[model samples]
Target: MDRMPRWADVILIPLISLILAALLSALVILFIGESPIEAIKLMISGALGSTYGWGYTLYYATNFMFTGLAVSVAFHARMFNIGGEGQALLGGLGVAVVLVYIPWPHWTIALLAATASAAAFGAAWAALPAYLQARRGSHIVITTIMFNFIAAALLNWALVGPMKAPGQEPATVSFPEATNLPTLHDIFGIIGIDWSRAAPANVSLFVAIAACVAVWALIWRTRLGYEIRAFGYSEPAARYAGISPFKIIMVAMLISGGLAGCMAINNVQGEAERLVLNAAEGAGFIGIAVALMGRSHPLGVFLAALLFGFLYQGGAELALWMNIQRELIVVIQALVILFTGALDNMIRMPLEKIFLAARRKSPPPPGPDRKSTSAEAAE
Candidate 1:
């Protein structure tokens, strides 16, 4: 039997962890001579108060959703693909290449082409590291980390040398006007709702939502997902069952990299309209925390991404209006990541014990033959 109920594992544990993180953050704010209550009010108001705030929050959530799903996929196969940063960069390059070189008649076709290009470029970048790990038995973590730097250098060279615009800027020229995506404001305006034009959230938000659904189906409703989870659970047993470890590693990493690359559609094609240096803005690394908090489930990943997005948009608000240092905001975010990810067991163990005790204390239900058993015993 399981130590705890599935619902507790999926929902209760994360909820408790988030509460603890919030309490710790409140303490930190108190120590810094700021009112935690006021700080929280500002966060809620600034990140969720108006359409503008929602726009930014959802925009950030979109990026996190893609990257979180990437980490979740690889993690199912027991592989830590930390090279999302590099993969996302390459994906941006792919987006730039597609949008800059090709002349598409419409935005929809351009969006589809850019997505494919991004996924392909991201997968290609990950292929080498996957090969090294699968064939040579090299550690995936170390290799993927190294590849991040290599990918950065390559992107830098590409931008500055070949793909650079006519000016001194180390970025490609702006994408064609026809390729520009419709913003949330535009979409909502059609439905008779006014949205903030300044907000970056766009059609990619829907794409992110679709990706979540696709991932859930892939991970829970597919044969390959079963093999990946089985391999992660026990590599030796998987091999005995005819599951190929090499295939699992390569396929998982490729999928992970492709998902990571897909983030470019949100930040690059949807928002920026041109790829720039550090375009990823550290969303790739943030994905690790998102995956950890979400428990590597697609639904969990979506919710966790939303939470992180709130923090991001709220943090910016805090800095602008509250005069709170950016570092303090980072500290708050770190504390959240710490409790939710690193100190997860601190919350989980207690919950397990509590549930177990409750289960033990509960009375057993009457059996179908209870009266007959009692009569027989009396006789």
Candidate 2:
């Protein structure tokens, strides 16, 4: 039996952790000669206030959703795919390859081609690392970390050498106008919603939502998901049940890389219209916190992604208007990650104890058929 109710374990723990994180953040802001309440107000107004703010917020959320789902999938197989950064970079390369090389007549076709290429390139990049881990017993954490640097180097060489536009900056030329994605405004305008015309938010937001639903189904409704979860729970038992460790590891990482790679569609195809260095920013690493806080669940990941998205957008506003140091935003994010991931037990253990004590104190329900028991004893 569980020490706490399912609701408490999933909902209460994260809620309390977030509250504690917020309190600690408030204190930090207070110490730094700023009104914590005002800061929060600004954050709300800046991130959720205008259509423009919503656009940026949702854009960041879209990236986080993809990367978070990627990490969550690998996590179910007990593998930490920290190479999302590299995979996303390769995915951008894939987008670039498709957009520059293809002769698609319409945006929809271009989008489809870019998606396939992005996923394939990302999966290819991850295959070697998965092979080493599954076959040679190398640690995935170390291998994936190393791959990040290698990916950076490769991208640098490609951009500065063969792929750079003639006498232009170290980026590919802008994608063909035909390949340009429809922004949120275009989609909403169809329904008369009238979103901001200049917002970078696009159809990719819907893609992120679809990805979330797909992941939920993949992790919970399928036989492959069962095998993955069973292996994660106990590898020895999984092997005894005829599950293949090599297959599980490889399949999990490949799916993870594909999901991570899809983030490039939002940034490169939807927003940037050209692949550039550091296009990923730090979304890949932020995904670690997202997965941790969300407990590797797609629904939780969606909400957690929105929270971080708010922080990113609001932090920019705080730094711009309030003269708050930009690094303070990093500090706040670190505190959230620290509490939700590292100090999780600090909140959970106490709640478990409370629930257990309450359960023990409650009287047992009345016995069934006490008269029958007495008659039987007498007999």
Over the stretch 1-379, how does candidate 1's per-residue lDDT look in tens digits? 4556656767787777778778887887788788888888998999999999999999999999999989888888888888898999999999999999999999999999999999999888888999999999899899989989998999899989999999988989999999999999999999999999999999989998999999887776799977888887789999999999999999989999999999999999999899889888888888887887788888888998999899889888888887576556566557667876678778878887887788789853444222212111111
Where does the lowest 10-residue lDDT sum fall in candidate 2? 370-379
C-alpha RMSD for every candidate: 7.0, 7.1
Give lDDT per model, in order: 0.86, 0.85
TM agreement with the true structure for every prediction: 0.92, 0.93
Off by over 4 Å in 2: 364-379
Clashing pairs in 2: none
lDDT string, candidate 2, 321-371, tens digits: 886876676776687778877898899888989988897899544542333
Candidate 1 residues lying further than 4 Å off, grouped into runs, are 364-379
The residue-level lDDT of candidate 1 at 357 comes to 88
Highest TM-score: which candidate?
2
